[model samples]
Target chain A: MARKTTQTRKAVVTIAAWLIGIVIFFPILWTILMSFKSEGDAIKAPLAMLSSPWTLESYGEVQARSNYALHFWNSVVLSLGSTLLALLIAIPAAWAMAFVPGKRTKDLLMWMLSTKMMPAVGVLVPMYLMFRDLGLLDSRIGLVGVLTLINLPIVIWMLYTYFKEIPGEILEASRMDGASLRSEILYVLTPMAVPGIASTMLLNIILAWNEAFWTLQLTTSKAAPLTQFIASYSSPEGLFYAKLSAASTMAIAPILILGWFSQKQLVRGLTFGAVK
Target chain B: MATEHSRTAARLMVSPAVILLFLWMIVPLGMTIYFSFLRYNLLNPGMETFAGFDNYYYFLTNAAFWDALINTVTLVVGVLVITVFGGIALALLLDQPFWGQGIVRVLVIAPFFVMPTVSALVWKNMFMNPVNGVFAHIAKSLGLQPFDFLSQAPLASIILIVAWSWLPFATLILLTALQSLDREQQEAAEMDGASVLARFWYLTVPHLTRSITVVVLIQTIFLLSVFAEILVTTNGGPGTASTNIPYLVYAQSLLNFDVGGGSAGGIVAVILANIVAFFLMRMIGKNLDA
Candidate 1:
């Protein structure tokens, strides 16, 4: 009797869960569907819109109208460049803090995390003036630099948590076997840290890719990322739902795939490993 | 692990990150403080005279400042309330025994990854636009008027859109927290014939308290600085109806060219965020010790 009741309950739960899930995901699914429709049909009643004939005109027009390739390249450069630069700076710092105990390590980690909380507007005036004077405005290098700085603490924190979980004895064992300092890290620690590093990389890429605040404020035409490019459609251009959907679909698709895979790391990273 | 040579090496390795972060924090912050007291404007760039407290006085006294403050708080609290409650409900359902759970979970969590510009723009144009949006079509089919969401209830509309983007985040974190619960305890309670509501209220809710607090704290940090949504949707329109401190600061400094006033507003925003940051740091700090 208990087994039969549980089976019924499970069936009921499945339908309810799927229903809610589709409802929550409907906007995105709608956008994708509308991307394939003409402007007139795209904005029609929901059932009519879904049943309309599909076309590739909007996608083609989006590419022809805007420099979509340039923005795509800018996004790739900023997210990847910043994540790689952050990794280079963060690994050693995380290594030292993880293996070498210091009295101020915890406090230092907390202080760095606090910097992430500092409202960017608090310094927007100076940063803007600084960017203007340095001729860094709307330049990929400037965007990369700022993104790297903003995300550095998070990269370090994620690495430190991962490294801390590793036993120090292994590192010490490699050192005692006459391994040079460079080789110890290159061979011993690097292999063990790969998973953590990959997860950190994945999470940060999504973050950097979707980071709207700084990217929106800092860049204009020359170095505008996909975020800014999509935002440009918020004007009258966005009224053409088909083209808007096509552009948005392109901007968010790659990161959405990456974001799905990084769900586990995201929990660990964003919460500062508090929940985990 | 205690050799002086290695300790020196460690310091050398860590110094680059430390030095860079320090410079990043101090330089701009120092300049913002310095600028707050001067009569500065971008357009009238010249030798600036000092104006102690006037920028603060004007910014503090302005009607728009108060409205922005209220709107900012409303935006934060409104989104928090919706997401936290909705997240708990969704998390509970997702935790249940079900078929096709993986696909449903993926579908539910998809929005968090959509870039803000895309989500805000899509919601504004595709879902909420009165003339041709889906909602209008729905209303018209029912023989009702097409309602203009952004203009009529700009702040509330933003709150809904922002909440949609954030619900996945809250659900994922809370679900992760839920999965860590000891099933043996739950089964034992079930054997004791505890009612479902009683079980949830007494056992599950208590267990989720820490995770919920973490969600609230983290979400508060991001919500306070919501910019792109407003920039895209309303541009803080209908006469400062949706303008938050971030938007106001951008307007003053960039649009109005009043650097000193903008700096003052920026400092106030920092102070407001720091108050929340203090509590959040304490919470995480305790977790680290545990």
Candidate 2:
């Protein structure tokens, strides 16, 4: 009787959980569905909207209408560019702080994390004015610099946590083997650190990809990423539901996949390893 | 582990990042403070004079400032309440053994990956549009009036959208903490005849309190600066109804060209965020030793 009741309860719980999950996911699913329908059919009653014949017209129209490929390429460049730059600067710093037990390392790490808290709006005016003065406004290189700075702190923190887990004995062993410091890091450390570094890169890419505030404020038509590309749909002429859905779907699909892969690192990264 | 040679090399390796971050933090922030003191306007650049805090006076005394402040707090508090509580419920449900748990977790977490612009636009046009939205269709089919969600309840609608995006984050974090919970203790309590609710109240809530605090502080920091959602949806709209500090500052500086006034507003935002950051740093700092 007890086992039967437990089985029944599990079934009930599964149904309830699945129902709630679908409800939560319904908007994204709906957008994907709407992207397949024609513009006129997209805004129909929910059931009617879903039953309409699917089409690839909107996807083709999105690309034709707005040079979707350019924006997609821009997103790829900005996110990948920024993450790579941040990784270059952060790896050494995170390595030093993780391995070198200095008196101020804790304070230094905290200070770096504190920099992430300084709201982007707090510096918007000067950044805009400076970017304008430098002719950096709406330039991909300029936005990459800004994205790199903002995300650098997070990359360092995540790497620091990951690097902290690497045993010190290995480095000591390499040193005793008459390996130079350069070779020690190149051989002994790089292999062990690759997974952590990869995870950090993944999480940072998702962050920079979806980053809206600076990306929206900094870029215009020439350098706009998908975030800015999607925002263009807010205008009246861009209100076709099907096209908007198509653009949004394309904009988010890559990051959504990347995000799923980085779920474990996200908790560690965002929480500064506090939870994990 | 520390040799003098390595210490030097470590310092060298770290200097580039430190120097860049230092400049990044100081230069723009200094200019904002300097600009706030002058009667500057982008429309008439290089024709500025000292304002003697008049900009701050006007920005603070203005009716819009108070409204933005209130809206900012409400948005943060409202979203925190929903995501935290809703996250707790979802985490508890997912913590149970069930069929297709992985798929359900993925489905629930999908919204967080959708960019803010995409999520806000989708919710605004598809789900909340009164005339042709899913909600309107449902309402009409049920013999009720279709509700204009954005115009009638702009801030609340925004709160709902923001909460949906963040709920996954809170759930994922809390679920992680929940999984770490000692199963032996839970079963021991069960054997002791403790009610399910009692066991949860005593064991689970206590274990989750640290993560809950982390979630609240971190989310509060991000929520205070919500911009794109407001920008894309209502544009802080129906007359500043949804304007928070960031949007208000953006409008003041970028839209209105009142650089001095906007800088003042920006300084105020910095101070406000600093207060929250102070507490959050302490929390994360406490965890550092462990």
Candidate 3:
């Protein structure tokens, strides 16, 4: 009886998981389907929509009209550029906070995270005016600066958590072997923490890449990322459902691929400190 | 002596990030506080004057302020409840051995990576449209009238979208936590004649307390400032049905150009968030110290 009950329970779980997973993923699948349809057929009955012949007209039109190359380039540059800059700054900070026992280290970390909690709109106006005055509006450099600052806390926090997990004895041994501080960090500590660093970089890139609030507010034509690219399709010239879906598919396709490939690392990085 | 010198070096290495973040926080916050005390509007250009608490008074007393405040609280609490409960159920399901487990996990987490704006647009067009949406089609097939999700139930719709986006986060955390549970404890419970529900309540829920706390705190921080979802779906309303504090601040400043009043509202939002953060920090502090 117990074995039978357990088998039944397992079957129930299997069916429920599949159902929920498909439902959760339906929108992305639907959008991809719509991207391949003609505009008229894209909005038809669901059965008819699927039955319609697939076409690449929407992709071709999106590429021609919207400067897809520029938006794609901006996205790559902004996401990667901000992640690298943030790491360059965050690693040393996290290293210190992790290794060096200071009375204020935990306080400093909490303060940084608290600043992150403060509503971003509180500072949006001032940041806007500052960027305007500095001629950084609609500039990639300005966005890199903003993204780096905004994401610094997460990078530092994640790295700090990772750094703590790695026993200090390893670094202490490196120092005993006559390694200078630079070589100690560059050679020994960094190599040992490569997985952590890699995951942090990957996660930060995803966050900065998908971040829409600041990206939309701070950028327009000159430096807009794919989020802005998707936004433009919202008010199209006509009922261009297919074209809009194509733009969205193009915009999300790269990140989705990256996410799929690195999902394990992404999941690990997110839940690293939380689960423990 | 060398240790002391390295400590100094460590401080130097960390200072650049510290200083940059300090500037990032203080300059804008200082400006906001200063602006809240003055009569300022970009439109008027040069007629700035000291208004003291007038801007604060106007913002504090506005009906939109309360509406946005209530909406903000509702969205945060609503999304938290759905994600936490749904996440627990999904995590439990995924914890059991199953075929295609990897595929199911990937599909479950896919929505989290979709850009929030694209998700909102897809929901608005394909699922929630009054005339031709899937929900409408289903209702028609079943001989029931479909209600406008984004119109009649704007706040509820926004909450649903936000909850969907965050459910994976909760699930992932709980799933990880579940994986690390002591198998011995479960086996021991079974040997003692405990039923499934009893074992879950007695053994599993207590083990998941830390993860549950982390999910709630982190999701609350992001959800309280939810803007993009509301912006793309309902534009904060058919009225102010879905305007949260962030949207309210945007309408006040950019739409109305009331910089002074907007800053005042911004200050209030910061204070309100700090209250929430206070409890969260205490929780984190206790959890970490444990």
lDDT, residue B265, model 1 = 94
* Tens digits of per-residue lDDT for model 2, B1-290: 68899899899989989999999999999999999999999999899999989999999999999999999999999999999999999999999989999999999888989999999999999989898889999999999999999899999999999999999999999999999999999999999999999999999999999999999999999999999999999999899899999999999999999999999999999999999999999999998952
lDDT of every predicted structure (CA atoms): 0.93, 0.94, 0.85
Compute the lDDT of residue A225 as modeled in candidate 2: 97
TM-score of each: 0.98, 0.99, 0.95
Candidate 1 CAPRI classification by DockQ: high
True contacts kept of each: 0.86, 0.80, 0.63
> RMSDs, each prediction?
1.2, 1.0, 2.1
Per-residue error for A75 in candidate 1, Å, reads 0.4
Residue B19, model 2: lDDT of: 95
Scored against the true structure, residue B277 in model 2 reaches a CA lDDT of: 98
Give residue B125's lDDT in candidate 2 (0 to 100). 91
What interface-residue Cα RMSD does candidate 1 give after superposition? 1.2
In order, how many clashes per candidate? 0, 0, 0
Chain B, candidate 2: TM-score: 0.99
Model 2: which residue pairs collide? Answer: none
- Candidate 1 per-residue lDDT, tens place, B70-155, comes to 99999999999999999999999999999998899999999999999999998998889998888998899999999999999999
> Which candidate has the highest lDDT of all?
2
Candidate number of the best TM-score? 2
